[model samples]
Each structure stands twice: as C-alpha cells, then as structure tokens.
Target: MPDTQLRPLRAFAESLRLDQVNLTERWMRAVFHDTELSDADRLTYEQLSDHIPAILEEICGALEEQDLDQVEPAIERNARKHGKLRWRQGYRIDELVRELDLFRQMLAGQIVQFSESRPFFTRRHEERARHFIDEAVSFVTLTSIREVLTERDRKIDEYTGRLERANHELTLKQRLVGDLYESRMQITRSVVHDLRNFLNVFSMALQLMSRAPAKVEAALALANRQAADMKALVDELVEYSVVLGDNHQAAVECFDLRGLFDELVASCSPAVEAKGLRLTAAFDDTLSTIVSNRLKLKQVALNLLTNAAKYTKVGQVELAMTAAGEDQWRLRVSDTGVGIGASDRERVFKEFERATGDDIPGAGLGLAIVRELTRVLGGQIRFDSNEGEGTSFEITFPVRLEAREGGEGGPA
Candidate 1:
C-alpha cells in the first residue's frame, strides 16, 4: 500500500483514539487489495475510523460472486473484535450493514461531482448508495442503544452490591448493641440483690442488740462484722464494674502462695472460731511461689476460706495444696458443710447466685468474686460437691519459677 493512502486512515484512527498499529495494518491491507474507493468514500471511512476495515470488507464481499459464504464469517470476525459478538443479539451485524451503506453513498457523491461525462452511471450509483445507507443506519442505531443499556445495567449492579454490604454492617451493629444492653442489666441486678442482703443482716443485728442489754457486746460485735462484710461487697462491686468499664492495668508481683494462704487463715481465725468450725491448712512447701496480682489473689483466697468457714457447722474445713503438673499447682479448699446441689453448682459462680438454703447467711458474692479474680490471674477454679455431704473448691495456678516471673511481666 502507498504511504499517502495509509496516511489519511492513520490520521483518522488517531482522531478516534484508536491504536495506530492496528489501524495501520487494516489500512495497508485495504489499499494493497486495490479496492475501488473514491476520494470522498475514503475520507468518510477515515472519519468513521473505528468501523472502516469491517465496513469495507462487508460491502466488497456483498458485491462479489453471490455464493454469500463469506458474509457470516466477516460478520462474526467484526462482532468478536468489537466484543459485540452474540448470536442472540444481532446488533453487530446491523451496525456493519449501516456503515457499509454510508460508505457507498459517500462514494456515489464523489463520482457524481467528478464524473459529469458519465451522468447516467453516477445517477445509477447514487440510487444504489441510498438503498444501502438506509439499511445500515437503522442497524447501527439499534446496536448503539443496546450498548448504552448494558453500561447502565452494570452500574446499577455495582450500586446494589454496596447497599447490601452497608445493610449487613448495620445488622451486625444492632446485634452487638443488644448483647451489651443485656450484660449491663445482669450486672445491675446482681449489685442490687447483694446490697439488699447486707441491709437485712444489719437490721437483724440491731434488733438483737435492742432485745438483750446483757448481750450488747456480742450484738455489737456481730453488727460490726456484718457492716464489714457489706463494705467488702460494695468494694467488689465497684472493682468489677471498674474492670469491665475501663482497660485499667493490674499491678503484678511475685509472692509465695502458701504464705498468702497462711495470712488469710490467720485473718479469718476469729470468724472460724465464732462459727465453731475447724480450719486446717495443708500446704505443699515445694510448690509455693506464684507471680500474679498479690492483692487480687489475696482477696480470692480469703473469700474462699471465709466462705467455707461460714457454711460449715461441724467436721473440718481443709485447705490442701498439691502439684498438678510440671508447672502448675492445685489448691483445694474442702469443707464438711451443707454441700451445694448439682443444679446450683454452675450458677454459684455467677454473681448473687446462692444455693437454696435457710441457714446460709450473707450475700452470695464470695464465690463470684473468687471466679472472676481467678480468671484475671490467668488460672482456673472448679468445684466438687454433694448435697448433705461436703463441698470442695479447687484452684489451679502455674508453679514454675520462670513461668511465675513471666506471668508477673505479662498483660493483665
């Protein structure tokens, strides 16, 4: 193909933002075939640069021998190249016919203006050109409308996907809020129930003091003890609330678990003696040290010991320690008291949940606080009990000296 002939097509393809390499190849092929195209036809095909190659091939093949075998192939090729090839949608075929008709009319007009010597021939060509132009224009318009609709549908799908994700997030947030509300309500009920029990005990002590002037000393002592218990309950409620409400860091320390137990036993000796309960401590001297929050651990140990002493009427309340594994030790506090029922075992660990019995006194926050404090110290607490027999509470803590140090430095 001559460089001059290819130049116009190349310039037109560039104007349409079509690839230069692809347009150059198509233009060269057309010019090399020695196709009969007038100056006006060539210029119009260049202006409609994107459709030039397919339009030319279709028109030329239609004018050839009437076998019509090449027609389907040519239509399929153009359709596939434009990504519009679909048997169910005949849009591409229609577009090809329309463009060919436009090309023929432009050719006819060029012949009429330049061929005055052959007026009859120019008029005949113009009539043929008009017929093809009408057919081609109708098809092109249909295909273009379909393309626009496809784009609109794609955009709608994208928008619908975004809406679905937003709705899913809203549903998740709603569920989380509901869970938070329920937990808050549970905590509130527990605090109120514990406070009511403390008030009842205070009232009983005051009445006892009023009825017997000779027993005033004993009544005042009992009242003071009840007041102290109430104060401890209030403090626990506040601490638990603080733990749940804020992300406060706990102070860590290394101490002897046996020593802590000894201190708690000494502090509660008066209560044990008053209740006429025997308190015994059997420590595994080899398994002593544990790194944890010293104050919290002390509270847990004292609470469990006092609880055992409070409920037991006769026999012994034993605090025993044993090695659980290579790096863990178990501390079991067993009491020969009115044991917990099977159904109440699990519930007792929850705040304000007490076994159904008339003799048991004070609020039911001791075991609950023990459970919470044990968890905070990175340990586990479990119990074994048979109603009318006895109850045993076992707590496990890591014992390895290195592990104890590591726990001291770890997050609470």
Candidate 2:
C-alpha cells in the first residue's frame, strides 16, 4: 500500500531514466523543427543530440532529490558544454535561449501527459512532477547562459580580425546621380560600389537567418566578414581621395603578376562556383615582374575579373598572363558568359554603362575603372565578343614603366 502511494513520484523519474533515448530524440527534433532556431538543421542528428541523454539522466537524478544541489553540478557541466558548442557553431544568444525554453516546455508537457494517462499518477503527483521539471530546466538554462556569456569575446574577435574573403565579389548595384560630377563624383561612385556590395551580403545574411535557419551559420559568418570589409573601405576613402586627386599622381610600386592574380582567383571563386562555372588562372612561367602602380594594377585586374565572374552564368572564367614580346606582358580574362552585343559595344567603357543588359548587376563603372587603370599602367585594353558566345578581353602592358603613365589614371 505504501509503495502504491510513492508510484506517482517515482513513476515520472523512472520514465525519464528508461525513456531518455526517446526523450533526447524528441528534444532534438523540436530543435530542428523550430523556425527561429533554424540553423540547427545543419547539424546531424548525432551532433544535435550531443550531451542530451546525459543531461536527461542528470534531470532524472535531480527529480529524486530533496535539495537540487545533489545533481546540479552535473547538469551545470553538461549545460555549459552545450552552450559553448552552440555559441562556437554561430548560434545567436536568443536562438540558444529559445532552444532551451522549448526543451523546458516539452519536458513539462510530457509530465502532464504521463500523470493524466495513468490512474495511479493523480493530481497530487502531477504537481510534484512539474515542480521537478521546472527546477531542472531553470537551472540548466542559467548554467547555459553563463557559459554563453563567457564565450562572447570570441565572436567579437572574429568581427575585428582580418577579413575573411567575400563569396560574391561583385555586387555592383549603385545608383549614379544621372550626370557625372567630375573627380569628386568619381571618388564617391567608386566607394559607393564597395559599400553597397558589403550591405548586400549583410542583407542576404539577415534574410537567410529569418527564412532559412538551416543556413544561419554561414550567413552570419559572411555578414561578420563583410563588416570588416566595410570598415576597410571607410578607412581607405581619405587616402583614396588624396591619392587620385586632380593633381596628385597615383603611387607606383612593383608587384608580381602571379601573386596578384592568385588573390583575384580566391576572391572570385565563390561567385563562380554559385553559377556552376569553372574558374582557372594561368600565366606563362617566363612572365617576369612588372614595374607599375600595384594599386592601379590590382584595381584593374579585380574589376575585369569581377565583371567576368559576375556576368558569366555558366561554363568557365579564365585569367591568363603571358609574355607578349620584348619587355611586354599580356593579361587576358575570357568567359563563356553572355557576350556584349553590337549595340552594347559603344557603351562598354563609358561610366555607368555596361556591355550587357540592364537586368544584370553591375556598377557600369567596372569596365570604366578597368580602362583608365589599364591606360595608367601603360597598357592597351581591347576585347572581342559575340552576343551569345562569350567575351575575351586582353590588356598588354610594357614591362618598363613610362614617365607619364602614372598621371593618366587620376580623376578625369
């Protein structure tokens, strides 16, 4: 008779002990099912269920205790680990909290269902079972929060550190103010392209976090990286305006063509992959170092590559540099992208003009920048294209720097 009286209390505790595997699976699915914490979808069932079974065991132990201290240490340890793991995995604090809150509700509801199903688990046992679940949940959430706070600095470091490369290199959507405003106008439009590109990535991240939680981690990481890119662009504005002023000469320095093209390949890889396009870089082994403005050279190469990668929806993008002749090297970028039309050819290197349709994303300034920079580096730029086939652009630069070459690239 006495054993029957204890049935209500021990029944819930015993159920937790025996049904932990199923309970853990339920909690894991709940996480996966949640819309706000959608990033959990990326995790495999095994990874998502880490430490859950053990945490349930601790909760079972806690339910049998007169004072909660007996089992809290174990719960705290596991809860803290879970928190750390999620934070490192790019979970927002609110998402983490929501995840735990859902578990607490699930655990509480399970107890209610158990008591209502069995005649022996009366109202008397129902209240006590709920109290134990509440205690376990509240304690677990508190421990998890403390661990999350401790790891917050790591996330901050990620934002302030060296910028990770951007996936889409050319988000070239900038609204020019109709008529060009000369040099200052050129400076403003130049940075507007960069700033807009970064914001586009951030916007994409927010959208993914809201609608497709499974992609939250990658989206957030990309946003974090672009934050640094924005900062760098801001810092460069002061110097950019000064360097490219009406009278000032662009700084000239020698740089290896091989090293520079490799960087462009890395930056453009993600965007190329998204279009199912193959991107390859090749330069003749005999090509030696070129004496030119490294900054102008990089900007020229980047603009051409970005334009090529962004417009080319399929096939491949290729960059190649080879020795053209005595003291000359030729750089070429070819793509199986939609080629420039006969009508589009007239606007190819004009400011705010594109060699493609209006629907495509471009600042229209990319080719303009490429043309001027190519001229300043003592290079001649030309291309051949067919409307449906693709385009090949080649720029040949003299190995020896010309005296007046540096002055040509400054603001028009």
Candidate 3:
C-alpha cells in the first residue's frame, strides 16, 4: 500500500470516530433534557448504521447488480490494503457511500446541462452518467432502510418486555384477591355451624318442657333452664355481631362493683336453689367504683354465677369481691364442680367451644362473652381449675368512685 492513500484512510477513520463521539454526547443531552428523538433523527445521525448491508439490498437492488465502477474498485482496493478501511467500519462505509452517490448525481446533472447546450456529444455520455448516479443512489437508500429496520426491532423487544411485566403483576393481584375471598368464606361457614348447634339445643329443650309437665316437673324445669341458656347464647351472638359490625367503643361510667354483684346474686338465686347448689357472696363495701359499662358488667357476673351453679350440683359456689389495689378491685367466683381440662381452658373462651360435647347443655358462648365484656371494660379475667375438683375465675377492674364522699364499709 502507498503511504499517501493509507494516511488519508486513517484520517477518515479518525473523523468517523469524532463524529460518533459528538453524536453520542448529543444523544445523552437529549435524554437528560427529556427531548424525544424520532426515526428521522436515527437515520440522519447514522445511529443504526450496523444493518447497512440488508438496508442496501432492500432499498437499492440496482447497486447490487451493477458492475464495479472506478470509485467502487478504488474503495475495494483501499479496504484490502488497509484493514481499518474495510467494510467492518460499517457506519463509515454507509456515510461515505451516501456522500459519493450525492456527488455523482450532482456531476451527472451538470454534464447533461452542458451537453444539452452543445449539440455535439449528445445522448451516450449522458445516459452512462445517469446510470452510475442511479446505482449510487440505490445503494445508499438500501443502507438507510436496513438501519430503520434495526431500530424497529429494538422497539419491538422493549414493548415485549413491558407486556410480560404487566401480565405478571396482574396474576399476583388475582391470587391475593382469591386468598381474601377464601378466608371470608371460611369465617362465614364457622359461624353458620355454631348457629345450627344452638338452634338444635333450643328445639330439644322446648320439646322436653312440653312433654310430661307434671310427672317430670323437675326435668321440665331443667329443660326450661337449658332453653334460657340457649336464648342467652343467641343474645351473645347478636351482641358480638353488633360489636364487630361497628367501630364504636362501649360507653363507660363509674359504678359500684359490690352493688353490681348483689344484683347478679339476687337474679341467679332461683337457678342456684333449683340446682341444689349453695350460693354465697363476700365483699368489702369500701371497694372503689369501677369505670365500665354497668349493664355489660352485670351480664358478665350473672353468666359466671350461672355457670358455677350449673356445674356444681351438691357443693357450694361462692362469689367474693375485695379491693385489690389503690384503684382496682378483684372479683372471684369459685365453684366445686367437674373442672375444665388444662388443654380446654383456652379453647373454652372461643365461641361454640366446649370441653365435653353432649354432656354440658351450652352453646359455648358464656366464656367468650365474658372475655369480650372484660376487654370492653379495660379489665382482665383469668381462671384456675383442677379436673374433677373445682374451678375459680378471678376478674380485676379499675376503680372510679362517684359517691366516695360518704359510704359505710359493709358487705351489700
């Protein structure tokens, strides 16, 4: 290779790199500034020039068929002589070919105009020049088309990726919705099962009370008492529904715990006597008033005493209350009955849960209601029991007295 031609080719390669560098800087600036670039920008800047061969074949078939002209021979020769000047410099080849085509066309036009003015060397030279110009134009057009196709392919790939991500997100959301629906259905089924048991118990009690009213008066009374227990169970279910349905807290007021216990004992005395269970109440009248829903507290105490009386047939059940601390009092209901198993103690507080099925005539809402009421009053209730011996429940509540000015210390 001659040094002269090699030096020019080297200079052209360097110039191409400089052009690419400048274009890259502009591309970065446009992206940072949030300026959108079009397909025309990609074409004009030669950004997608890698697909030049395919583009040239599509857009300029005449160039592929044409014999090597003087410029084509020179380009091939330089590519062979210097490896850097080969078609591997794809963008440079594309740009240079495009410029050559434009220049050839311009020269052909000038030659035709000059030949038209002079009538001597008329059509032949003009036709040959036009053919060369057409071939050059076709080659450059093909290169441009290939570049455009490459850009299109890149866009399609990006679109496909985005679509896949969207589908994945949709599937995740659908699974979450299905899980939520299943959980809701399970809760509904459990509630329905509990209701069915309570209804069956009420029906049986009503039928027994109607049959042999005089001859089995004691049994009838027991049946009626069981029926009343079912009614209370239903009422508690209603109350629980109301509490969970709304967001309102229970209305609290200062109340006498001792007085509340007195009312509960009086109300449950009939049931206690009927069951042959001895009932007793021991309290300190000096106990402070507790801040709570008075009606709910009374219901809790009544349920505890009834439960004690129901379980204990021959032994005594006692309701004892005393001041536990400066601002709290403790109430304990102890009974000598067939006590709960350790494993069943916690389960007893859940709705429709019982230690023994078909033995105890209860829908299992007593302890559940007790727990709910205690929580509503900001109090705590706990129990201790030995199976076949007895059980004792201790309840604690904060004190808030209204008539703390004057009161005698005595059991109500």
Best by lDDT: 2
**Clashes per candidate (backbone, < 3 Å):** 2, 2, 5
Better of 1 and 3 by TM-score: 1
Stretches > 4 Å off in candidate 2: 1-246, 409-412
Best TM-score among the predictions, by candidate number? 1
Clashing pairs in 3: 55-142, 55-146, 56-142, 56-143, 289-400
Question: Model 2, residue 193: what's the lDDT?
Answer: 70
Model 3 stretches astray by more than 4 angstroms: 1-233, 243-246, 401-412
Quality of model 2 by C-alpha lDDT: 0.75
Residue range 22-130, candidate 3, lDDT tens digits: 4344433443333232222334334333333222222222222334353454333332322222223333444444433443444355446556665643465446445
Supply the TM-score for candidate 2: 0.43
Residue 56, model 1: lDDT of 44
lDDT of 2 by residue, 153-221 (tens): 666667546333231222221222233345457666656876777788899899989999898899889
| Cα lDDT listed for each candidate | 0.60, 0.75, 0.58
